[model samples]
Target: MVFTKKKIWFSSVALFILVYSINFMGYRDYFPLFLLPVLGILMIRSKLSKWFLITQIVLLAFLVCYCLMALYYGYFSFFAILGRLIYPSMFMLIGYYVAGFDTPKNLKSFSILILLITGSTLYGMFSLIKTINLYGSYENVMSALGGRLIEDLWGNSYISATVLNSSVSLGLSLLGLLFIKSNDLAPNKRILKIAILSIFLASIYTSATLGNRTGIITVIVSFFTIFLLKLNSNIKGIIRLIVFIISLYILKLLFFNLNTFGVRSYWESSFIFSRFENSKVYDDPRYEAWTTIIRNFNENLLGGRQINLSVNFAHNLWLDVFYDAGIFPLIFLVIFTIISLISLFKLLKLELPNIYKGLVIGLYTAFFLTFAVEPILQGFVVYFTFFCFLIGIIQRKLTSATY
Candidate 1:
């Protein structure tokens, strides 16, 4: 195949996603930086969207101003803060560069994303089992896996993983299932879906092992949303639903029933289960952060205060926008997000393949769940950039069809 501009764009973006998804040795953190030269070239060649350009300009302005304020106040070093902001600020560019094309048209187009989802999931499972073997107790395992002490809004302390946020990666991985067809992976599509579903099921176990409820819930939401959106009253759909639920249950049983080497009891006693077992699940600290930020919005209307001093971030995407760059950028982002979501819903109704539609639905819900509580725009740059790139494709398709 000739490496046309479109192909180059797809390959680079796909490779970026794959590298970040696998996250081997923390390369995920810096891979985007390394891709700057290539992406910059593509950006120059691509016809940028007006909406994207305006939004990027406004966001960049706010970021510069915010960093200046942080610097003057001795909150942090100016260069360090600005350097960190660089990757996140590239989201608009990522979106605009790929907006001219459709979503990947063939399996080859989606291969890297597939490898990302399946490979990361398998790696997560392996990490969980390895942790178990290395540390016999739940507490020991969690601490060994880079967990740190965190207190909830209610002052309940538990160990939460600090090094890696597995939920986002896993949630993003679930989107790969959207590209799969019944006939693609196995003897039939049904078995293929089930096989991938099984990998994700074990990922739930991995989440539980790490005491990551968000990861667990996001996986369930992804599965449920994709199926629910595709649900019709037809008999075949009903049968698939039944089989899906049954398969999920059976998969769950198989994972937990592994009695060899006391793994079953080990899983049962893990921090995730123990939290629920003791009814200590409602320990959210986001409420406090949200309230404080909202109340202080007037104080920081022109420029945000240093959020790192309090909760590292506002803990909500919109609130983080409000808290980090003030109301102007917040308003722009909110309007942009609303429009993007409308585009997503519109894309779902179009005459695309079920795989693409499911990808749209699954990724939207999964990311929404994460974006609501976590500071995705600033904190999860790689995932946010990929999301922007995908949404850009949606916007592009919608615009092209209007003509």
Candidate 2:
């Protein structure tokens, strides 16, 4: 396919996969810096649609949230709210690119593009094992992997792996649907199959934080949706699901630790908040910050904003909203999200291609979990791209007149 200016216009929304795909090379490095121009490109050419209009309204509502924050707390706190959007907005641009790939043939082409990225992830895991570098406890993990800490990819034990997990899980789950549809894939197709399995296993073996759980759960939800909706129609799906369950159980025994720190912590931190809010641990500061947010919201629920919220996102996405903006924008965000979800659920009823349905279901589940965990992660890139794909798929359904 030639690089046409029209198609390339949506490259910005492709920002989520591209940024994280590069991050597999270096987390918190120069790649994020390069995303700026790509995002700027999106700003220029992104055409307006219902999805686009909704997102803009949501953001505008959030700005009102910021106003409430400023008036109540007398602190202009919009940047914190804006910061959450940086990555998500970039991802929304990718949806525009997907919009162009609306046909079955184009879907196949786009699937290849996704696989190419997943392929790099397989290589990254091997590179990690070959040249691992460990610091502190990571050194111990490397010893466990039998490569000193040198097997540590990018000097971070799980960062690269976790990001790849998100990309590969979404990519492979989508591809699996396609593969199941055909008995005669190309000669090189086996490599893609290997890549999918390898990345899936790697994601399980790699130690993960709370973020991993969201992706894991998302994949499960997506596949199950596919299974219920399509697997019953094909015997291969039953076999694939049995293998998947067995594999995840086996990996859980080898890797998944239920007692890990942040990953283990429940959303309700009341007891911890009571005890540690009085102690010097980071938990102590969280209450103060949370308190700061609530107080501000009460003062100006309409026009508020938060600035320079301390390190590592506020954990609770809704709380982050109350802390940064205010309540009303939060309401708008909720409504916007509800509408998109309803749109997809409606699509699932149509007798569309299982491959397309699986991809959409899996991504929707994953991003929903992500939203519960992280505020900014639930932004434009993920939602926009996802819905745009749905829109394209929906267009096909329209011609079918499948209500």
Candidate 3:
């Protein structure tokens, strides 16, 4: 059947909502299994390049072998296994299909969809905060919210959950809003734009609410990187930097001095603050997990091995790939990332809208930061798959001559 733009639009939005809801509801390993037929339809309609297809096939082949091993070892059920396979495949197909939508109409539609998704995520964050206020601690909050609680080896409590794909979605959505400027809007509509922007900006505090330092850091770093790229002269850059520092200082003073709503104490009692107070920057369970995985490298060098739930995967994307699918798949992962990054760099040099450029930088930082620390491939595939979708956008921009 021939696919019209309207059909593609509906399908894309439907797929997006389905995937996001599955993740948001914490049904990653169960609900997504049923989406294979939908994903199969997407695969049939998606037009991927030879390289993405080849690399995806090789990567999936290794993952398939790994999944079989998992099954043989009774690590997960068949349905869960199917869900695992479908998540990455579905995102890749959707990425390919959506990335080619570079027209103004498509961008506007995507902006609306992203706004709705981000708004929903904000609501979830608010709910989480309210729950925390009522409970006073994240312990046993998993039932109320949809996240699991964990106490580390150091006797510290953490609620390692987010409204969307672990705050990466929030950060990227904000960046997308920043980049996709609606400059032509009438003056009367500017207030609405500013209000939306304000809501999103305030949502950064939601990172603290979720105790997600990575999210906060990625957003800050991405903004700084974008700011640096926009600088045309050293003097102007320095002036801007000084102004930014002054503004931050003023905000800091206002923040610390105010205790009107008792929000400061709540923030301090939040998970992110607790982490900063209790742990050093390098002091994390992931470091030990990485060392242990490497120490037992030979055990997972072939068909890989089962992962422990306590520490999750290796918490490093490449190491997890090596530990789960063995050395061959790890090599392919490196190849895939390198190719995407190279293309991203090439896209950066092209004359494009500042919004897309900011997205490229912000997404790059967010993806890398998460990949370095999170079990993205196994537990948070939505984040990485979304990164793949951004890569598809980058590829489209690079191939387009009219931009």
Measured by TM-score, the strongest candidate is 3
List lDDT for all candidates, in order.
0.59, 0.48, 0.60
Better of 1 and 2 by TM-score: 1
RMSD of each: 6.6, 9.3, 6.0
Task: For residues 1-403, write the lDDT of model 2, one tens digit per residue.
Answer: 8878745644543553454553455553234446687657755785456655565456455545544554456543345334333433343444443544455333443453354345444444544444433333434554565532333344444433333334433443443343444223333556645655565565434313212344445555656765666666678868877887898787665554553344334423433333333555345444455566665556645433443445434544566665545567668667656666766777677655555565566556655554454443322223323333444434334334332
Q: Write the per-residue lDDT of candidate 1 for residues 93-172, one digit (tens) a residue.
A: 65544445444344332244344555556545554455555567547754654553322112222323422344334444
The candidate 1 region of ten consecutive residues with least summed lDDT is 150-159
Better of 2 and 3 by TM-score: 3
TM-score of every candidate: 0.71, 0.56, 0.74
State how far residue 255 of model 1 sits from its true place (Å).
13
In candidate 1, stretches whose alpha carbon ends up further than 4 angstroms from where it belongs are 1-13, 49-84, 89-112, 115-138, 143-163, 166-169, 172-195, 232-268, 277-283, 295-297, 300-313, 377-379, 399-403
Model 3: per-residue Cα lDDT over 280-399, one tens digit each: 766778887887877777777764454443475778888887776777767667777887778777877876655556556765776787788777656655566566555655555555
Residue 359 error, candidate 2, Å: 1.3
C-alpha lDDT (0 to 100) for residue 26 of candidate 1: 46
Cα lDDT, model 1, residue 208: 59
lDDT-based ranking, best first? Answer: 3, 1, 2
Q: How many pairs of residues in model 3 come into backbone collision?
A: 1
CA lDDT of 3 in candidate 3?
96
